[model samples]
Target: MATTMDHYDGFRTFSWFADFVGLPIDQVNFVLTQFTALILAGLFRSSLSPIAATPAARHVYGLIIGLALGYFCFGRQAIHLASLPALCYVAMRTQNPRNMQRVVLAIALIYLSCIHFQRQIYDYGSYTLDITGPLMVITQKVTSLAYSIHDGLTRREEELTPMQRHQAVQKIPTTLEYFSYIFHFQALMAGPIIFYRDYMDFIYGHHLPGSKSLTIFYDKNSQEKEIVLEPSPTLVVVKKVVASLACAIVFITFISDFPIQRVKEDEFLKNTSMLYKMWYLMLTTMLSRFKYYHAWLFADAICNNSGLGFSGYDERGKPKWDLTSNVDVYKFETSLNLRDSIESWNKGTNLWLRSIMYERAGRNKVLFTYALSAFWHGFYPGYYLTFASGAFFTVAARSVRRHIRPLFLESQRKKTFYDILTFITTRIVMAYMTFSFILLEFMPSIKVYLYLYMFPHLLGLIAIILPPRLGLSKKAHKQSAEIDLSETISNGNAHKTM
Candidate 1:
């Protein structure tokens, strides 16, 4: 029944449905919606006064991710169980111990609804899991594995039987699409991966407000970096927002062009114009910029929004921004000798990085973080190439920069023609990497082109975009903080509003 024209028909149908439902057909709408929602969702988690730490926030943050997974896997015919994450995140954020039972029940009810609804409209294909699918997979896999090990020690008469304590392994889906919920493209579609373990601690772990740990291999000493909130409310709360927005937005247009990402098998045979090359870069980076800026924008927005009324310090007597994105949530926010683009952009994700890989990896934190980050981007091929190429080269660039730091720091090297070439090269590389990511994200076709030719030309470009330490703004810094929900919630029924 399929034909050459089926693709066009399918695409047209999807567009009509999206437009009818007021969903964005382009990547820009996609970026803004998820990024803005996630920031708000993170705040809900921070306000939970979590009795225990959990990735409950991702419940809310995962809403968008769930939506995409549902639509893609189940098609637009029905809503999927992914929306439960948002609701769960919101419910968990409520500090009332009495609400626990209600939260559980609500979660169950919502999940059941999605499961039944999905079942009726969409068959449970191998890949098409409902709410309990992932949990069941993990549960069965672990139980069966444990049972196998237990049965080995002794005979059933003398030792534990698999049924008594062990269980059978659950069936796995053959198609990836059925379990697409796990590989959320919307919630974390553009951002970094946040593990469940780390997410939980933020909600319930009751350590010091800013006591989470962060270690980076990039630092020779492997010192733990603690984020201190600067006392200048106006600066952290207000001024930097505009900068983050500007820095994020200008490049967004360049990233939104997702079509540019498809790796072309052979170079376009007709390509001869400089204008073609120019459009290629512009469209690709636009997509990445949209996502990058959206994350920065929302984080900044939440912090400022929460910092609106109560002017108070943390238990440690440090100034406060919004605890939602505050650095106090992590162990440290240390400095590295050389700054790279991916690291820089992700660091802008607030405390998510610090509490995860940065703290766990110790000295090799940057490298570890970068590698995982690249992988976390998606189940895609080009992202790994971009991430690995960028990470290694950036590390090398940092090492080389250290040698020349004295030159820039001491003002020994003036901006000569050669220096300008280096500057242009670095910036162009930055632009190129950013462009490649966006293109792959939107277009998918450009990845081959990127890997074959553009990626190779980026060596000189790296030098251009990297900001010398001298150029880094020596502004007042703030220490990150953990918050009590009573304090962070909007007096306007903070928890209740959601």
Candidate 2:
């Protein structure tokens, strides 16, 4: 045990900085390496432009930098990062073309699951940084790439969705390019999970806002023309960085005061007023969310600085740099329904769940997606609890919107009131659900929910059991057809029947 401890301790070259910052060495390294990547992103576009002047150059540069950063941050364990992806690439090359998606997904998920299992057993409930973080990101990248490749190779273009067609990989990437995409420093740590096709486009400069292939215009004379516009990411990067800093500040300020573990304490659970417990849950969960917001925003800024996240110009002709944005702060915080809230938070992973899992499911896509999400997250009992709760909440939220929301939509004042009501309700629901997610243990999660009277779960059950007709008369149901409850669900794959 001492030898093993020394082996792990050998990776602690940054112990001085860790000590100075009053954080674990691994965490200090995670943040410091990202700061290093951010600085490198600027240099890659400016002083190091020549090194990244061509697609091949860019691939090599990213691979080298990413590998170095991974090793520096994770030491010998970092080898696991490249090995899994390389094995998956080999599977893609050798596996039956039709089974490629299943094969690769299994390999990635199973490999990641083993690591997750080891982590859980080794340091149960600890939040210590490990190679598992990058492995999770890599699993998404490789599995999504597998599905996209299968779509391109086996499925007919006519049968594919427009987004699928756009993302499908027509040709298998060269080994170097595949590794580069897998290891790209911009997203390797905490990703928004860029698609293989999109990453290639970014590398080749084919999807820049100013790229002719991406944007076009018509002249006043009505002649066909291309409108080229230069888009700078300075504003987007600045705003995201500032927002991330604010999130970091809020997290640092309140995390210790309202740690999620407080709810599980025997004294608090046994003595605290239910109302105060609810408030505590809300505050702590919100603070926990800020940690993700900070990391995702910083990762996004790195992508923008490296000229990789430019999507296109908006209606007002301002550039939109959200191609790889993981979260939308406004929509995420203010979402009035489960569908919108789920879509807003962890936007990339939601997209992956939609395209890769839900869209491909034969039936019960919602349940299947949730199950796959729970599995992908880890073997944690609390993860399963959270996702199971989310599935129920999804059904209830949908029913409420379909039945109750239309009654309020008829009047603007009522609509405003409805929005306000749903906003508060959604936050509370999210807090309740996220409480388990933070605790990440079966007994603690169950204990807290039990203390809270499990009201949210019961509410979901009640909402689901009560028929839509109970909340809406036949005439009102007919009248509310125009309400378009389906519109709330993103990606057009919203399960309409259930």
Candidate 3:
């Protein structure tokens, strides 16, 4: 059996299963796509490691994740995930950890789990609804709002500017450099889904308030390494240039071997060599980070292909005067893992999703939380059931955590090989749960149904790995209510005055 990859959900953002469903047409339907786009953007930001961690980094991560959501909900489904944000009270309720907060949080999680399970039944298992039909009136409003900021929000285009061209001309073949911006079809499929806050930091970050001071934000007088987007028309040209180069690179590399469809078990055993299979799977796992970057880079290149050194930050925390992160945009590419994932991709919409949907769902009402997630993914029965199942299992896992923390603590004190073994085993199990949705996406059988039926098994499975609860008292979540308004402000450029 092939080992599963990391962030495989990127592929699932726009599920192939949705292909067997209907496609939305017309201005009304098209406009409605924005809701889900917004929600994906929202969730992408919401589900990240907050911006202290560098809002720009987290926002960029959100944007990457948002691209997938936009591809799924806006690009595919008529129902926009953000359209029903008002209904997603659980997603936003993170700060209020009241009495018995853990229990409340768990319950909310369960509710969300159930709802998400329903999505598996509905969206994934071939049930389709124009869902936009019922929300036409609301969508009309969304249509208007979308128009005002849609171009600014999605920020399309990928090509370099005259200076970028000159730089390229100075380096290698001009034609090859220009070609890099267009062929990344993967990016065209959806969006740049960058975090609003991180984008903000990349721009007006120097002027930012609070801890981002030169003493803290940077010691240099010229935090000029920052990539402040040109407020003028030049940005469009720059993006086009950068996008063109990135596209050209991907066309030569990725499109040549676009593994569009997944391999079935039997076909894999017979046709591909073990080494090749290992390589492919490794690519799948590692490329999740790349897949994210490719989408964003194309969008960014499209925005910044202009040859001006308006401002830019290399993937490192360092700002570049005009540095090249790519030797070829192929041989030298930054591969972002989970940590980086949270940093770079932010969408404006996820703030609401987290501040609204997932956060609102408490430790007690996980079912509602799953319900909200299911609704976001789709109104399909399979999606609802599958997601809910995941939530139920998540709850069970929490119970297991209650049991495990103490023992894990005791074990941590000893600092033995057993701790390493236990830690790895725990993480592996977590990883499996993380990608369970990916597995369900392809399997399409009663066995998948069976897994859904045993959704609680997630709890059981986790407990099997985690130590049993030792009656540990729950401490108030100190992380709650600590709003870095300045940091939050810096997360998204669109939101700031830049």
Candidate 4:
């Protein structure tokens, strides 16, 4: 047994079962931890429903589960968990929103700095994968909290964007509550990045009540406000978990067959036809999405199981189960435009970027937001490469949609053909653009792009230059820009779904 386990050493230190199974430890631990969270969520929901649903009780329950899981997965490294909440508490104690925001961001950056420093010193070539994953989620939560506090306390309500207004943190939570929110077991590792207000509302059962005033499209025949009781989310949770399990199985079973790194291989580049190469890239990108699909769906199911993802009814009076969904898998797979593709993938992160960065940037919001997103992701050069490429892609895609899409939309057949063309184009462009993000290194990413002929980059340049000459005047450009920005930022209805 010891000899067998030694062969599986990578999967041994974390758990006895992992050692017994002789599989990679981190993978086993990750899957097991997610499963544990699901079980705990169900237990907590059933045990605490209507009886111990106070904020304090919820906080205590969350803290216990989060800390236990942290220790089980990370052991002594779990000590680092205290640092974020400690700094956040200090920020709250300052009682000044500006100072609080500054302090919280500073502390979060310092924590990230320490993580990078440790990676450089000890694990230089390991790529800093799962070990620091939770820290990214923590960074988003802390920064969002700080910003929300500022919005509520310092900024005038009239000046705030609709999202900022809805997510404003009116009071400083108790230390226990703050820590619980930060370390919520469901979202601590993989997240949908719930806002502080949304989490608090769920805790107090206030989410369902405040929906009447919010925008809700009713069916044309329905006039009466039917008092629909909030349905139990057990069914929703089960469905999502099953879907996530399927994604996980697909990733495990097929990812090796469609290796992303094969694109960089000399034989593949030299021998593969352009048509086959495009197909390969699409398949590789689709496979890459499976890992994220599993994580986000699992997190969504956990939140729903705990009754934290309730967002009230839809147009047809059906309950919405996507309040905490990070990805709309169908929309992501079939996205007809760059904006929709980007927004559909990692939606929670997009919501955070739009709310915290895009809406606040004074000039060049798109550039600033993408830059901030890259920086927030990490120090990887490939991240910058992807973001830079993404900026061009967004411009080209938007220009095409604005100037060309209307021409085809006059008839259903034309629109269908256009949608199909755009869908394929979007996938290919995105796959080409984001290959670097998966690779996470500068030279390798550039090498792959070069092998692919860099047609997308060249096309984007042409779009940028030709748009203005094709009746796209400066005034029209500005108006188009505002329309795009409004579509992303100023749309209050978008916030509700997220």
Best by lDDT: 2
- The digit string of per-residue lDDT tens for model 3 on 308-375 reads 12244445644332211111233223311121122223322222233333433556444654564455
Q: Model 4, stretches more than 4 Å misplaced?
A: 1-16, 19-22, 124-129, 210-229, 472-498
Model 1, residue 72: what's the lDDT? Answer: 44
* TM-score attained by model 2: 0.92
- Residue 488 displacement (Å), model 3: 16
Better of 1 and 3 by lDDT: 1
TM-score of 3: 0.37
TM-score of each: 0.42, 0.92, 0.37, 0.88
lDDT-based ranking: 2, 4, 1, 3
| CA error at residue 78 for candidate 1, angstroms | 12
Which lDDT tens digits does candidate 1 get at residues 363-482? 766667566455333334445656655665565564345334324333435525335645544554555555544434434435444433555345434544454433533321111011
Please estimate how well model 1 matches the true structure, expressed as its whole-model Cα lDDT: 0.38
In model 2, which range of ten residues has the least summed lDDT? 1-10
Candidate 2 lDDT by residue in tens digits, 218-307: 779998855444466788888988998899889988899998888778999999988999899999988899999999999999988888
Residue 238 lDDT, candidate 1, scale 0-100: 50
Per-model C-alpha lDDT, please? 0.38, 0.82, 0.34, 0.76
